[model samples]
Target: MKFLFPIFALCALLSSCQALAGSQAGTEAKFAPETITAFAKNVEKYAAAQGAGAFIIGRIGRPQQELPKGIRFTHTAIAVYSAITLKDGSTVNGYAIHNLYQETGKPDVSALVVDYPVDFFWGVHELSAGIIIPTPELQQRIIAAISSGKNKAVHNPAYSVIASPYNNELQNCTEHTLNIINASIYQTTDMRQLKANARAHFKGQRVRSSRFKLMLGSLFMDDVTTRDHDGKVVTTTFSTIGRYLQQNGLVKHMAVFNRDGSSGELL
Candidate 1:
């Protein structure tokens, strides 16, 4: 049984990392092509306005089978922006995006890698996105955590589309991101202790799914264990994390652009 579980876990990771293509049919985009294009072009501008520090951002990417509810964005990534000076005495702005990338058809916990927003939004299905600029204190903590490899340490590599929001044992992209945020705040890489603290600090959203969807998830995905959807209904997502930060006063500023091309403050 133990060996079998690992095999199943591996299968799930492979399916998640490689086939990032949206599982849900591309729904009608909320913004017209021009609007989404312009938004992508100005991503750096918006990110820069958050200050040259470590922050987090999310985008409405490939539609997954688990249709989101009351959430504006589905995928999340950490953005660390800084300035670079070239030998020619010119300064340029650049960003290193810290995110979890699932490899193609691999059954292991995805690793935390630095990806640019251009690459990050390659397959985005919507024009909407959200950015969370952490407080100065929180920003330093996040940067420290990443430098100390806490982000890599907390990742489970096993991808679960319907991973329990509370559990850190099996993680998806958002859960992995959450673990990193929690670990950074606590200043520890100890997974058990972080999970314990998260129980109190993190409150996930209650999401409901149909039996058909649950069955499909269970049959194909190894990480979506029976415990995922049986009892607790809450799941961690981009919006939930933003709400948590905003409610806790850890965020300095938050901005969200809806599918309608309208922009507003999240906090």
Candidate 2:
């Protein structure tokens, strides 16, 4: 009977979602495409209304009931204001999401993808959105960093759902987002120094550990690994990134938005 809980936990981890970093293949959309498009449009509009040229975005990729303890959003990435080209070859100004998406059918590998908000939220289970807007100066810096191609240079395609922020051994979407943030701040694309800065100031979320859970994780090391941490399993998360920017006085707003366009505290 005691083993049942661990089995369920393992199922949750191996199911449609991969931690709070990115979504896996075979996930279904709870909302219809039109509904998703509307909600995504509103999210993009909200960020622009806040004067956010660049911001961090998170989504609830998995069912809330299946999420692990202390994990809220399931996928996170960066959104930048840009002129987006449509299928008709006409361009419109809006926010474009930059994602480190786990390759379809290959959960262990990821790729940097530039998509719009509708594409970002297309597979979400819920209509909720998490947003972290950096201060104006920081926003400009982030935009500049991405513009200079530093964001792409810092991306490590080796994907782990619970990747460590203090090292570049493996990376997920959230860790990648944090890496780009630090790159923008330090004004350098030096991966080693960026990792050093993260080690100095970042506080990653510690995955609640147990002997049985650790055993299960080991069996699926391709998806979740703790070799990066000598102690507890400390992995970068959306909340950790929010806390880092909030504490450093680089955040203009940290908030959550519902489908109804209501606003609330994120963390």
Candidate 3:
């Protein structure tokens, strides 16, 4: 297990999605359940106050030090404000996170999961959150994409931690989020054209791990791979996505929502 540290570390830094490589990566919770629940509610309240209908939410699924130079979040998902029915049959307004989670045992595959904020932060490494509130038009577009089932059309079950955003050869959480947004904007499920648009306008975060370490990680973890990427490992990250939306005037606001009730600039 000691020798596997380097392999896991490489995966953690290069991965744009959740920490799914090591045994405890996705299962361990840094804060108590009650504390996480309170923090999750706080994030939800903050987004609601901003009038965010649909926004991007990011979480740190691994220790901060394990993250690389340009990466801040280990996982990202789309959160939509909607009415949720409780176990007791009562309904209330809350945010529902749409995520691409690696199957519990099958790390190479993923599934679309709709969960609440508390569940979203239950297995996190930190209480902080990355939020990107899309503009009113884009928010409606995103909600439409999800409701029309276009989101599932763009999902690739063959998961990769460092999937290229410019192509659909493989898919990760961030890429899926981008795909859904593009589907909404372009009003099409054409993956090829969506990817082309991304290549033209979006600049992905370059992965800085060495090839030797990358290869080592691929040898051990099913979700770790750089094969789809040719030379430089450029994949969509939460920050890059925020910048893309901001530059295109599709974002209403973006910020880092911390547990201490303070906010910081996202870009």
What candidate 3 gets wrong by more than 4 Å, as runs, is 1-26
lDDT of 3 by residue, 1-267 (tens): 799987677656445233423211246677888899899999999999999999999987777776766888878899999999999999999999999887888888888989888888887878889999999999999999999899999999888888889888888888889899889888999988998999899989998777777777787778878889888988888999999988899999899999899999998
**Which residue pairs clash in candidate 1?**
10-107, 14-105, 14-106, 17-102, 18-104, 108-157, 109-156, 109-157, 109-158, 110-157
Task: Find the candidate with the highest TM-score and give its number.
Answer: 2
TM-score of 1: 0.76
Candidate 2 TM-score over all chains jointly: 0.92
TM-score of 3: 0.91
- Candidates in order have lDDT scores of 0.66, 0.84, 0.84
lDDT of 1 by residue, 1-267 (tens): 778986785555444422332212223555455665566657767666657488787876645443455555666778877565658999877766777765545533355567665555555766666788888998888888887887888877766655666766567677777887888787787877877776778877665545444455556554454354447556677778888888888888888756554679764
Query: Which stretches of model 2 miss by more than 4 angstroms?
Result: 1-21, 24-27
lDDT-based ranking: 3, 2, 1
Q: How many clashes show up per model?
A: 10, 0, 0
lDDT of 1: 0.66
- Candidate 3: minimum summed lDDT over ten consecutive residues — where? 16-25
lDDT score for residue 73 of model 1: 60
TM-scores, all models, native as reference: 0.76, 0.92, 0.91
